[model samples]
Target: MKIKKVKPYNQEEDKTKQLSRMFNTISSKYDQFNDIMSMGLARVWRKKAILSLKPYKHDTILDIAAGTADIGIKAFEYITPTQITGIDVSEKMLEIGKEKVAEAGLNDKISLKVEDVSKMNFADESFDAAITSFGIRNFDKLEESIREVHRVLKPKGKFVILEMSEPRMPIVKQGYLLYTHTLIPFAVKTFSNDPKAYKYLTKSMEAFPQGKEFIAILNQNGFNCLKYKTFFMGVCSLYVIEKYSS
Candidate 1:
């Protein structure tokens, strides 16, 4: 598949817009790059994230930055409320997601839209659960996105997240840096033309606050039940949180 070329990211739009533009440009080859870089472990990581949340039948789930709707598609099995909405800020991403939803014969069940995670267009308490798989770290105002998520969710709503992290173990962390920062970019350059996107991805993950710091951010955002589950020996993690009821 050919990756679309997006204009250079403008620093003027804030960090979130720049990141969204980067992902939107590379949307076509996203699944491929993710699978190749993770050695197909990304899918397993996503499954672990989904399992962290306990949803009843037909729950209203809002998946943020849901590129091509992978999590939304997988979450279908638990959609007792019939289906869920997957929203992203990228029009190109939503287009691809919509196609996938139709191909899965879940067009009626799952809906896709282009909306910013930091400022949602939904009503209060509109959803029962929400998730952003490896997506929130790109938010310009990560706290704003978390609180935005909180506002749209009903009391006690589940919030699940799968994110990349720098390993805490001294040796493991160095190995991770070598692989993600160096080898991953090499692989992307070889397999895809837009190598800068991969380069940016590496830098962004490195800049993100992971593990305990991230959990602290969640807590600050009013999220309880903070559980950070490590996978692939801590190369990545899934954070599950909940907003308590009054």
Candidate 2:
């Protein structure tokens, strides 16, 4: 896929507006396209991320940017949290997620709300833990979102972020690059009418910082016990960081 210069809203100006526009535009086919592009490993990857959280039976968890409620749904399966709130900026996305949530008879246990990550309309120390999957790269003020993650969390709350990352080893990096930059985009384009959305995915992941660089940012954002474990040869990372009296 030839990279196009689609003018993105600077994260500094308005992240919610930018992401709301983009996510709502892509809502209808987002889940389907996700399954195809990731070759169904996305769910397994999320399951691993949620399992790392060590949620107790009495825990209350929030899944930020919880597109279609998949991460929350997976989390519920693993640890049976007391209450799970899934928030996102895209109403259309939330609608789709709600439908799935209803079908699973999880409307009582899981709540879906349209919300902005940089400014969650929740009281300080509102949740025991919070998680977001494949959504941070889209944040306009990535740093601010991290701080917000700190704010809503209880003093010792856990924060787990599951996101895409480029490979690190030279040979594996080249292989994954050619596949994502070329093959996957081509396949998604055939199934998706909005080639631009697929274009944005490739560009965003390529532009995102991950691994230790990302871990360092979390440490700076008032998080404690910051650590990460990689999957598929570091193609993605499950970051487990805690907020200690933050």
Every model's TM-score:
0.91, 0.91
What lDDT score is found at residue 140 in candidate 1?
A: 69
Stretches off by above 4 angstroms in model 2 are 1-15, 55-58
- The stretch of ten residues in a row with the least summed lDDT in candidate 1 is 1-10
lDDT of 2 by residue, 1-246 (tens): 122223244435454676677778888989888888888889889988888887422288889889889987777788768889999988989998999988888889899998788888999989989888998887767778889989988877888888988888999999999989889877876787667667778878877877767777778888865568778987787888888662
The digit string of per-residue lDDT tens for model 1 on 124-163 reads: 9999888889887677667888899999998888888898
RMSD of 2: 3.6
> Candidate 1: deviation at residue 5, Å?
23
